[model samples]
Target: EEALRGLKMAMKADSPAKDTAAIVIEPVLGEGGFYAAPASFLKEIRKICDENGILMIADEVQSGFGRTGKMFAVEHSGVEPDIMTMAKSMADGMPISAIVGTDTVMDSSGPNSLGGTYTGSPTACAAALAVFDVFKEEDILGKSQRLGDKLRKRFDQWQEQFPHVDNVRNLGPMAAIELVTDKTSKEPRADFAAAVTKKAKENGLILLSCGMYGNTIRFLMPVTIEDNILEEGLAIVEQALKEIG
Candidate 1:
């Protein structure tokens, strides 16, 4: 809901409204509570961009490579963007951001205009291609769906255990838990949120705190993490919540 609202706000921004090149967004708001934009919202955006002759770009940096239970989060909507960028977790975190777009949009420059990137050399490309091979061999995409199911189930268990937790919302592996002051404010327990995240880090758990107000802790567990390892991490999070008592 708010995700689409924010995009609308961005589109309405003065500079963008005056003269814009493109509209870029993560189909699933990764760090922003891992919220998945509804299909209707995506469809509307695509329609609007098409009508306005504006480019619609999907930033699949974090939600790419089976992270969202699919090879890409945008695939969930089946709506292709005019432009898209992807990188993270593609080459085992190797730095590479690719802009996939139509020739018309990308080949506007002349020769020698786009030839100064030695970062993703043959070695990195080979490594990245190899990762894709593994995805095919091991069916990483399927694993992502299964992993997300397990993760959500465990997260729900934790929410039940910690009644202060209002609920869990996620898109595949990307997930976030919203904490309430007492299950009533439904308005984020800011202090407790901080304490829990701090305690989790202290207990050897890496935590990413997010949400517009910084009152939510996001779990960006690697999709490659074994089931047991994810459970262990969950235990750490649970313990952290307990300590904040």
Candidate 2:
């Protein structure tokens, strides 16, 4: 409610409201920590967009293509967005991006109105097609869900065992843990996070840190990773935590 109120105030700050073109949001925050927005909040945003004649654009670059146990993170909210931008895993790192929009919005522009030098390279298109085929044949969504369950279980154990590991969270396999000076005060421990990532790298595991204070360690392992390989990677992370904690 507070967020929505703030959004409403921001919208009203501009005259006539239509001055605001669109509200773009990431259904699951990617680099800003792996926090999934509440479904209710998304629904409210949809409602506000409808009432205000503003388009709701969902940036699903990180949370799409089975990363979040669903094809798109916004599916969790059941709120249809006016436009969606996707990439990253779409072509399995083929460097292609796409924008999908409602028919009305898409048709608002004419042919050749939007064109870039490398708009649709045949190689990238083929790669994207192959990726879609793989998803169809491999039941990748199911694998993603199972991977998320495994990751959550491990994260829960870490939270219980480590004092600084606080606010363990995930949206499907898109998981993260926040390092804090202490759980009681929740002071961000950026140094601890950096140390853990550095240690994990030294141990042959590439880990990433994000969040406003750079105190969050995010996990973005491949959804198709073998169980044994996943376990091995996780062991490295745990070892890093122990050494740094």
RMSD of each: 2.4, 1.2
- Candidate 2 clash pair list: none
The candidate that achieves the highest lDDT relative to the unseen native structure: 2
Q: Encode model 2's per-residue lDDT on 1-245: one tens digit a residue.
A: 89888888877785446787899999999888989999999999999889989999999999999999999999999999999999889999887888899999999989878665445689888899999999989999999999999999999999999989999999889999999998999999999999999998998999989999999999989999998999999999999889887
List per-prediction Cα lDDT, in the order shown.
0.79, 0.92
TM-score of each: 0.89, 0.97
List, residue by residue over 172-224, the lDDT tens digit for candidate 1: 88788877766655777778788888888888888877777677888777777
Query: Against the true structure, candidate 2 has what lDDT?
Result: 0.92
Query: What TM-score does structure 2 among the candidates reach?
Result: 0.97
Model 2 misses residue 93 by how many Å?
Answer: 0.7
